[model samples]
Target chain A: MKKIFKNQIALALAGILAGTSAVAGTLVINGDTSDPAPKAAFQAVIDGFEAENPDVDVVYNLFDHEGYKAAIRNFLSADAPDIAFWYAGNRMAPFVEAGLFAPIDDVWADQGLYSLMASSAPGMTMDGKKWGIPYTYYNWGVYYRQDIFEDLGISVPTNWDEFIAAGETLKANGITPITIGTKYLWTAGGVFDYLNLRTNGYDFHMALTSGDIAWTDDRVRATMANYQQLIDGGFFLENHAALSWQEALAPMANGEAAMYVMGNFAVAPLKELGLDDSSLGLFQFPAITPGVPMAEEAPTDTIHLTAGAKNVADAKRFLAYAARPDVQTAWNKALGQLPTNAGAGVTDDKFLNQAFSMLNNDAPGGVAQFYDRDTKAEMASIGMEAFQEFMVKPERLEKILERLEKARQKLY
Target chain B: MYSYWKNNQLKIAPWIFLAPGIFMFSLYVIFPIFQSINLSFYQWDGLGAKTYIGAENYIELLDDEYFIVSLKNNVIWLVLYLLAVPAGLFAALFLNQTVRGIRIYKSIFFFPFVISQVVVGLVFSWFYDPSNGLLNIILEFFGFDTIAILAEEDYVTYGIIAAGLWPQTAYCMILYLTGLNSVDPEQIEAGRIDNARGWRMLWYVILPQLKPATFIAVVVTIIGALRSFDLIDIMTGGGPWGSSRVLAYYMYEKAFSEYGFRMGYGAAIAVVLLLIMMVYIATILYRLYQDEKGS
Candidate 1:
């Protein structure tokens, strides 16, 4: 009888110890880095983190990239992970407003991230407080075929008139001046954002996207008129509405299309398609209104700590680690994107070098997140559809703008 | 208790047999219908607290242009999808003859119905692809301008409906093929003796006996047309600016898509679809009752 009692006591003690360890030492992270490169890159970060903090046991859950969007809503309020992957700006606003994300202002102050990660600070901040740590961002600009440009003897255009002239020259040579696919619709959103940013400037563009300005305003029409110029010129590839963004790349690769308005992520795929550095070139989307300060589009990806996190201390530690310059440098190197940390060095690739310098030195106004990321989700969906419609049928711009105005009033 | 059961065994036996099915039907179907109707009166984002808005969602649906477009597309789908029934019947008649290796032809005809709807959607998407699809190639060969079928707002609905008919026709064909097996040969012989020719014989003799098959085919086709979502989702995602949307696809977009979680609005759409479906459902029930009473 005494030995049985002793055994029960021993089991109880072990259970108590295990429960305490699980509460204090285990950190859970959920992310959607399911692609091979990003999967491996994140796994390496987890390895390094575990090695540095041997006392903590890290558990990571990887979700399918497309499915993760729906899954985040369920897990955030029901069973939150310590760290969750997300995007910056208005994309994260719904979650932040619902108080599902925990604020980490102390972590930012302790790590001096306000200075170290100054470039992306505005994107990560909501209501005067930082809600997440932005690790990587990529620039959006015009990617062109250098050989085609040389063959036509057209120098890089720097203003609206020169841009139109160059496109006309390319079209006269039996080549499409630009190729874009709006089947998925966001490609057109990128074009609309850049046009609005250049035509009315960044502040006005922000106001319009934020639902503060009526889409029927003349400023929005000015942007649409500039877009109509390209459509009327027939500079875009034919039958683009039927193709995907990836499918559109084939025309550019085959020299049928000369330029693409795209993000830095297009470089790797272009290289794989046999376009070397000498054959492929990157340039900023040229000036439209001439005096609108040059703002670039650079969408930032971030990580957050959830409000329901149990291990807040370790989660904060992970956030701090993710914010470090060296860690971000290595992470962005693997991602083939630019580091959000101002102190971090970029990979020595041609596109990354050019993008890094362009974003830091040349862009003076500010970096805005791409259209879908900057605007409310419902607004983005409606706006992207309008953009796609305008690209296909520019004559219906009035009706489209009125539709957007109605949606904006209803949604906001 | 034994004496009570013995006194009312007939009534008790039927109740015992019906218990599980009744419980399940209420749980899965009947309750959800009521819940969706209730949800239509509220404003909820799926995660937040629901606010009672007193039929405001239905009010919005009246003004929503996308809703109108989806309704129009659904009507087009209903009218076009019924073409599958007659096509299937003719196909069945053509395959009814007993030649050598006739089973092979029947199997080939039934092939589409066996494969998944997703695969059907994909194959048709590739076939309709503008630059590289066989369709454009044929158009170009005929010295005609190639049309992007899915990208054109006017033709996108018809394009998706055509894809849907591929499998739907095969399904109806299989149904009629089975119904053909039980057809009375004696009646065909009598019709032949009476000097009935091909069209006359089929209309007066064969069709009356195939009434059960025709009834089933029409009901299933109507149901399938109302729920035509997968093809629209896979082919165009109701895209090129939501021109190809139907009620079912629009309901999904409103409730589940990344840019939407307007639960109340989605429920409103669901209620509208249910009301339309209820019309046909009521007719079906009435027909079934009349048939049952005649027997």
Candidate 2:
């Protein structure tokens, strides 16, 4: 028995030594890329990074998309990995303020990302310092049924009057002009962002989201008036509060609805449901108020370095690699999204090309992240709830705005 | 050590057996209760340093309309949930007869309780779906304009409670079924000879004997109603404007959800829920103690 114990001790010592050696060059990453396309895209990025740094081993922990929103808060403080996936703009502010994420200005400087990713730099920065590297973003616009438009002899609307008239024509024909699901609440937020961005211009919209302007202000009311016009016209899908975003797609797919004010992510599922590029088309959310510079909604996705990262050196290397134009081009191509790198090449997809040109040339005002990403989390929750309520009960706009103002007073 | 143990074995033996259980209970349950109560007094975002905020969280709860809405919904849940006790009793009485394939009938009635709550929630959500659901389809067939039951703020809570009742009624039915098996037949026969039948028979003879079963059923139902988080989460996510939020779901939303950052406020809500639960439990314990003495 003594001899067997001695042998076991010798084996245990060898195992411990081997573990330490493995830890020396391993880079741990935790991300919420559980979807198939994103999972494959991230895997390719890891493979490319590992190929460049032959001696390093990358350990990636992929979390479920929804669960990761809550899991990130736990792991960032409890068992911080070298790198983690997150969003850009105000969504990352809480973590940055708490010091859970480390500043990576050095990574950006070394990567020459200041000019390469200028469009996304403002989103990735906090307090005059860059916090993370934004890799990909997708545009939000009106995705309509091209066949339906042709049947009605309706052209794409470029202004608020034409947009309302298009909806009126669709409504006259017994079709819901817009199919939006407010069950999750964030979908209503996208509609609100477009309305506010168009009605009050980008600067005022930014100020309102940042709580520099009261929610009950006249500028906000102008945005609400535009939204109320759509709601009163019965433009949205019936019983939308009962459906999820995916469920709302059914009406559009079956021709019960003609248009959907949504993000590019909707294109994939819509195509799978048999609406190909010929049947589906994209248009900007139209200019609401004349001379209100046309900004666009493009929520950016980013990767961050945690403060408790064990392998800072190797993690920095991965951040720099992720920010590269070549790396972003391949990553976004696989993701079916737009790369943040100005020099990166886009995929040869119709919707992607249309969105790329729209954001690059048409948007002279600015690019605003969707409403939830542009505001405080608590405020975003309350604001989105109010928006959903307004969509369902347009008569309750006054009460909704008052409630939002109260929440803003307390939140910010 | 052996001599002392032998000399005081009767005094110390029970403690030795209880040590492990006591340690686990305190670690998992008792300690966390106190920790949560302590946490309610501080402002912590689940990440940065905690700041002592005294009674501010509780004070804010007093003015929060959402808190009041949650408390009101919880009250509604508690009252409506008790209906399951009688519903289960009637079901049990109906199924207790010995007939052709009686066991199959019992199993069919008990099926809801056997399945998971998540499945129950999903099935009911699909059943109440606005556009193509069976409920709307039937309503439309009857020439009644279709109503989105889960989406309307007025009907949302009642709809979820109806779904919760499916499994809860099954659970109570099972409890009463076993109680009915061991029921004293002599007293029931005597009561029948007294010409007591139907409601009178159930009220006097049957119900008196089913007290033990009724007691357990009521306790479990009240506890289940107070801790109703899963159904609310799965079905509506306390949504359609958060009109169906109960205290439990509200507490979770404030502390742990994707947008929640007010850890201290969530703990305060939890403490209020605990106090409400404690009032019921303490009264039940008092009644139990009184019965013990009476018997």
For all candidates in order, the CA lDDT equals 0.88, 0.90
Model 2 has an lDDT value of: 0.90
TM-score of each: 0.96, 0.96
Across A1-412, the per-residue lDDT of candidate 1 in tens digits comes to: 0000012223323322322222688998888787888899889888988999998888887766665676777777767788899999899998898899989999999999989888899888989999999989999999999999998999998788999999999989999999998888888988988888889898998999899999999888899999999999998888778888888889999899999999987788888887999989999988999789989999998999999899999999999999888898899888989888888889999899999999999888789998988898888988998888888888999999999999999999
Q: What TM-score applies to chain A of candidate 1?
A: 0.94
| Chain A TM-scores of all predicted models | 0.94, 0.94
Q: Which stretches of candidate 1 lie over 4 Å from their true place?
A: A1-23
Q: Write the per-residue lDDT of candidate 2 for residues B216-264, one digit (tens) a residue.
A: 9999999999999889888888878889999999998898777786899
Report the lDDT tens digits of candidate 1 across residue range B39-59: 999998766678999989999
Ten residues in sequence with the least summed lDDT for candidate 2 chain B? B252-261
Q: What is the lDDT of residue A29 in candidate 2?
A: 89
DockQ of 2: 0.51
**RMSD to truth, every model:** 7.6, 6.6
